[model samples]
Target chain A: MKRLLKTVKNNFLSVFFIVYIAVGMVSVCKPQALNIIDGFLQSDRSLSYLIKAPVLKLLDIRYGGVNLEPDIKLKAFYIHLNRLIQRVIGNDYIYDAGPKNDVVRLNNGYLTTCLPKLTD
Target chain B: MLFSSTVFLFAFLPVVIFGYYVIFRKSRLLQNIFLLIMSLIFYAWGEPKFVLVMMLSIIVNWALGLPAAKYRDNKVRARAVIAAAAVFNIGLMFIFKYLIFTLENINSVFGLQIPVPQITLPIGISFFTFQAFSYVIDVYRNDGEMQKNPLNVGLYISFFPQLIAGPIVRYQTVANEIKNRKETLSDFTTGVERFIVGFLKKVMLANTMAVVADAAFDAKDAISPSFAWLGALAYTFQIFFDFAGYSDMGIGLGRMFGFHFLENFDYPYISKSITEFWRRWHISLGTWFRDYVYFPLGGSRVNSKARLVFNLFVVWFLTGVWHGANWTFLVWGLMYFVILTVEKLSGIPKKEGRLLIIPKYIYTMLLVIFGWVIFRAESLGAAGEYFKAMFGFNGGTFISDDTVFYLKNNLVMFVASAVFSLPVAPLLRKKLMSAGERTRRAADAAYTAALLLMFVVAVSYMIKGTYNPFIYFNF
Candidate 1:
């Protein structure tokens, strides 16, 4: 214990991080303290993770509740929209930089709407 | 997975730290077993199916080490087994990483329809394969005694720190520690601090730089000349912090586990020449090739100039190929070779008068910045386009509104990157050591608080799930 303190006693950065990690441990122990960060970010862990911006903005799901619901309406709309677009465009054609690829769909090899649109 | 991940930070790291220290503290054997399993779990989490590939690597290397060691005196059998082990490691890398690349090139050139076996590269295959190769080769060379215990050998190869990315710790370096290691609170605390530094570098600087760099390269239209330069500079900083930061994290993590791995980077950007840059950058890999490959081929001690050139070519070519399956990496490696060749033939003293030093620095940075363009580009075509943009070859505008916007917005980041990329931490400690106790203590707290705040901000950024993979993960 003396050795630990002796080492920490000299280095201020060590002192700070020790306290910092200790605080994180405290937050882990008291989950309510972890909720403080949630005020800045999305309340749901998975939803917060899904948000891909650099800033800690709220996930603006239109549904309002204590218990969260998946955005089923938005999901269905995108699916139907994509289908309609595909039908209109027919085979081998699609809009460039439209919401079809980047927004609602996970990349599944066949129709990834990300960079390098050309396969070769 | 990624060391910078929420899962790795909050879940995997903390849990493993607790389990290794608290639960298995009393039993060394239990700790070893615990760590082996945990490390396996860690690798598996990232490359689930390739966990078997890694285990097979460990098993084959571990099995081969005995024979290589046993036949150390017998010339014929020793060379055969070593050759076989090398083949196995290199062969695994070729089939997985290079086969598709080879087939594509062949098909393109010969005008044949060879079906491409395009598979996603197994993560860390290069790192682990080289590590496994090091073990067998080191044993053959009698650099380290052969470990009889397969688990110990497995631990040496698959230790979580430096597993995916590396300083490429030589077997001889950790052979003893694999058998016996002691964890101290001092080392643990230092490790924590080092990890935080690395985490901040990755999360803050590298990732931010990546956003700008990726934007410039992936621009729908050709970016302005200045934007090309800006992207190139950002990528220069990005690759440095991204890889060096990962190395620090790896070293720090190794410290927590009582393994003292060597330093990997030494501020290569500070160098005045390309020769010095290679020395400071990726020191372990440089040394590995020097000792194992270069020295065997007569290194610089060859009688003829041709032999010396051949040695350098082999080393650099291998160095470049070791980076990726792509021709770009090979070219990137050869570019360095050509520069060094010119430097050698020119016979101009690298060390210049103080007045000439600035020009030397500019020369080094220019080549490196251009080299990184080749490195960061998706293809030779993209690289050519980027070069044209950088030099204003066909002519776009000098600067774009977006370029000015990025510079203005990221002014602080640019300044911070330049300042911190030097040996700032050590410099701070040196200056602080002479200050009065109270002053030093206050400075410490201030630095610590700043780091804590940085971590909080970085965590917030991370929770937003920004694109934050280490660039070397591709390598």
Candidate 2:
């Protein structure tokens, strides 16, 4: 009991400092993660299509076009970040599909593909 | 120069803090001078031309106040001086804020071909003018002595922190503090903590919600009923956090400068009725109006029923006009007046027990949300459309992808905002302080660390450029 009390008493400030550092690190890292995710969302077609599907489904309730869940955007953001990390470490995780429905292509053609699909 | 701006956090604040401590740490007079210069620069940074207007108002009020101070028994002259000062201050505010509205109304009503003149409304004109106006009135009323030092009076009028968006510090409230106040270590620490909490609220929560609210509000036609409700709810939270965050920062900064300004917001969301809400929310402005305007107009003391109603109308009208130049603001004020009048007539039932808390909260929240729709909408038509959408009149779906997207992206932040908006810190401190020495020590350590973490994150957000101006700066 004494030992446990000692641990709690002695390490309290240290534990707090660790949490502080972790929070600071996360704060610093979040924007970089967001930027990378944005890039991936811009590049991959299948991923983009998979993400937009749910959003498009949701958009049908509105004027039948504005489907895009904040969560899906966040997912796209994370996926993009993962891809970015892979790129930075020189791992080619982003597969280049030649000319057919890539995430990049799908994303760029989102208005045409998603809007029509929702209306139809 | 806004408290939430990146330039303010990184450049302006740091420099001001350093300069203040380094130059005027020991001397109160020197500190006041330094603050005045900094405040002048801050105001001039936004509106250089309006600085002259502020100066003119200050000089006029100071001059008016001086005569009233000297003539102790001359009631007629004292009344005249007060009247002149009030007219000039209110007149300037009217011309700048409401001239365009007046012109448009005239053109529509009488077929007058009056061209709307382009006039830039000075930020915080209403606030500073009210402070100046209050000072002169107080002097005439002999509630407080007139400030002998013009610079101190100038500082009171233009104190940058609360000048733009205010707790509307009455001249009398800070009169003694202006002449004599000491900055203590404890006060400084508390001030820093308060500032950090406010900063976190604005950057982490309010701004995030603002993005969704702005987008949904702008694209109203495409918005679902659920989306519209979400947007309104988001805006309700957003404006509270934004304005309350500003008031916190202002009060915190006031403390840092060894001044104790009045609390602007209590747990206003916890209020049960519109009357209770007014008492809690914008307490400073409400008190100022009550003391300066309402009581002087005979308040509820007048014998005739018509006179009492007329008094309420005048107070509400001026209160509405004080908020902004728009007819919407006027309508919003009148709406409150009508509701309060109704509440007064049909008396609120006596609270039976704690079980009523939930219903009361819901009641207040609903009223506040409707009020905010009026506040947020560009015009009455848009407000009506938005209100209709909220009720699903357009047969819109319950949940949209955009709605989910906003929720998902901001979920953590929204949760954090909810938790912090309560008096959690103060409550925890109170509990710990009463428990034992060890617990108190632990609480202090935790609080300090949390403050430091918040500061770093707030700075990071500012650096990343997500900072937004406080919502009430335009008032």
Candidate 3:
């Protein structure tokens, strides 16, 4: 026990930072997880195709809406964040010429569909 | 990635630190490999394509370093090898950093429309290229051994802490440590303390000053004289804290991993002359130029004054051009060359007079502040306009409500920045040390607590997504 205490005292900074960073990781990564899920669904990779249809079916959500069913307030926040990200990535300038695809128009006047944005 | 960013603070740094300390604790080679991979990832997080450019630099420089070392006994061949390395690195820098600037200048001068390609500069090109040069040159000079492994070369040049913005670690400084080093608990704690101090300096002081500086500078022609001066002063503190804080964090991170990089700054604001200021401010770059450029050109030891002047001119010209491909930076460098030449000839700095120190300090700081004005301006014309306002020649008032408003809002931060720019904290700690053993113990505990508080506050600022602009990242 004394040896344990001595080790902790010697490596106090390492201990402190490990605990602090663990707490920080949870705080910072939670929102990012939601964003990553959105990215996977929107991405053009073949792996994304495997879960895209079933996940959307399971959640019973529109292609444009937030998934993973975060709380209503959290979903609103995530949508706001998604819009901001879209604006930053120049997706806002993209306009829908026709609506043949399974598309939904966001209030921000940008199309929100599983298909890749025309800007890309 | 910026040290002040939440992603770097919470995600990138923690993961790297965990892997460094825990997973690879027993193996030095594995730790070095881990560090190199993580460094490349950290750099590529911003722009993935540039990783190719960096890898090209590492492989080529490492390849050159081998032959440079091999041919050391043959003077001409070794010299040729080092020259080739120099040209390659400089050519790479010129292509990415200065091709457009050079083309545009030529188009204007020769009255021909030369098509300039739009080149997006890879961040830290200046820093890493210089490190690559340092490695080859050091190996040739026998200051350090040649690394047989290309990954070790990559690790030295792309060490994430000092990679993007640097204290520009010399190759000789960490050559042995790359192969053999031990991380101690004491070094870890000290690194933590130093990193926290840098984090607070950057997030609290530099970012706050940046807001005021940006407001006035962005206002451009309409600013009052008082406001113009306030902007200059704000920028003065902003840059010092930003770059120095970065260097501190880099040094701290180096310590955590058991690499002791040299001090980059030493309270330059307290200098009594431009010469002293250069010695104190950005000591790494200054020394790099001195050892690599000036000393090779015979420095001040040339017998003829004309030769000495020529050498100084070349060094200063390159120094100016080294900052960026900007007329303002060039003019700023030349401005220093002129002042430094005058100082050297006049023997002003070495003169002994206690009463002269105050004026000497004011003179140095004023010149520095004006230099920063030139450095910070968008162009030479904009700098002139700003100076006109600063001198009340732009038809602007001396004192205005806007100036007062900014002053009042930022007075606390300004005062704190000014105080911390000196050696006050270190001096205070010194005095505390001499008081008593009990007092010293209490002081140590208080210091640790203060560091903890500062870390929490700095991280809070990061979480809040504050105004964090790194000035030296451009260079």
Candidate 4:
């Protein structure tokens, strides 16, 4: 009996970790839209920008003129934070942009003009 | 089956795993027979006719291996047998993969009317042939005993996991495991985790970057300096993750079957020099060449400069040509050989201590990024154009809105690939393993959960996405 108690004492942190992850997951699931946004931002850069640009625009409404560079940083933070949310929720809700809107083009804009038109 | 395919994940793997475990509970001999049948089925799924070619090679090598083992003491006869085996393997490879290229070059040079024969190159031919040849050579050299059982030899050659795209498991590495290996619960768990991580790396990371890489490489002359760099960088990561991911899957599947395959990659992107990069990348193939090809030709021990140059040239020449029947691949291999030779000749002191490591890594990365231009280009001329574009040599007016848009879209995936390509997971695992009891348990739990989540997402992606064949399948 004493040995069992001692074992639990030794792994107290693990117990706490499980509880923490569980609670975080529950909190994440409550706001499905935010969870989805977070999941999308985790892997999809274009989708990340779509979410961030609008949110930053709102923040700019309150703050009165946020610098473009700082807004980029803020957007990155949002994406990172949402990735954490995704891990906690254990669900992926990220929307995939269809093949029509090429994600590569968004990531590498310098190639747009030089890109060849597909005829067939 | 390709590692990236839905059929492989959803259909083949699950069935194989369940069937193997169900049979394994009955008898060990039954297990081997089950695995052999499954392997044959797997190979036939892709190329039904070519499986015959694989079987023919396996039968010849197995027969040769036994006799070579019997006459191991007769150096002359053994040498002749080994030579015949090598020629047969290499000769078949040449006819299938290089016949067209050889004929085209001959026609161009001699003004002949010889037409290039069209042939569909068999997938995984190079990998399986190399594995088969190595077995015979090992028997001839007395480095390992020939498997008395033909079934064991057959399993080693066509072991489905690493057979298609390989770290080229040697005859010696899995010789014991072929007869005796017991999988524990821990082994199965770790195997599942490894497979999950590899699947995510392929579906999530490598596939994402491949989109951009294909667009940029296909763009050819129209690609701007920035766009070309991005494309090349994406491809560099894409190829590494794609191949590394497949290797991890192969290794993981091996572990699940109670085999312990050697690690094929060790954070190759983190390499400090081109030499170090080669040491870490495709470690099995490099070691194979070093042991079988380099050492036999007198290696670096020879006093003659000519011999030294010859050994290096042969190793690199085979290395390049081993990848494909393309001039670009040959140049890519030669480029590495030149860099390695210069580094050796200069006698530069190896950088020591922590501070200099970053600079070394950056330098190595730059060299690798440049090398990918040759690897990805369709021809030598196209590779030259791509390299020139990388340096902003084509009048710097190539940047366009479309390029910026693509960059914007793929930015997240590109960055993720770059980060994950390092030794982050292994480093974390090491730390977790060494930590206190409580911390270790927590880390284990987190790692397991993360692996499970990654597996779910990866499978979901696989189901939705088109099948992408492994890059090295051609090699």
TM-score of each: 0.82, 0.79, 0.86, 0.80
lDDT of each residue in B281-359, candidate 4, tens digit only: 9998999999999999999899987788789889998999999999999999999888887766664427587888888
Q: lDDT, candidate 1, residue B39? A: 89
Two-chain DockQ for each candidate model: 0.06, 0.02, 0.11, 0.02
RMSD of each: 10.8, 12.9, 9.2, 13.4
Q: What is the lDDT of every predicted structure here?
A: 0.77, 0.73, 0.83, 0.75
Cα error, residue B186 of model 4, in Å, equals 1.1
Order by DockQ, highest first: 3, 1, 2, 4
- Ranking 2 against 4 by TM-score, winner: 4
Scored against the true structure, residue B63 in model 1 reaches a CA lDDT of 94
Where model 4 places Cα greater than 4 Å from the true spot, the runs are A1-120, B349-356
> Distance from true position, residue B39, model 4, in Å?
1.0
Candidate 3 displacement at residue B171 in angstroms: 0.2
Tens-digit per-residue lDDT, A1-120, candidate 4: 997777555544333333433333333233443544665677566866667655565355335543212123433443454444334433222223222321112343331322232311
Candidate 2, residue B155: the lDDT equals 89
**Alpha carbon lDDT at B33, candidate 2:** 90
Look at candidate 2 and tell me the lDDT of residue A27: 42
lDDT per residue for candidate 2 within A16-111, as digits (tens), equals 433543443344335544654665677674676656654444334234533212233443443455444323433321221111221222333331
Over 4 Å off, model 3: A3-14, A30-120
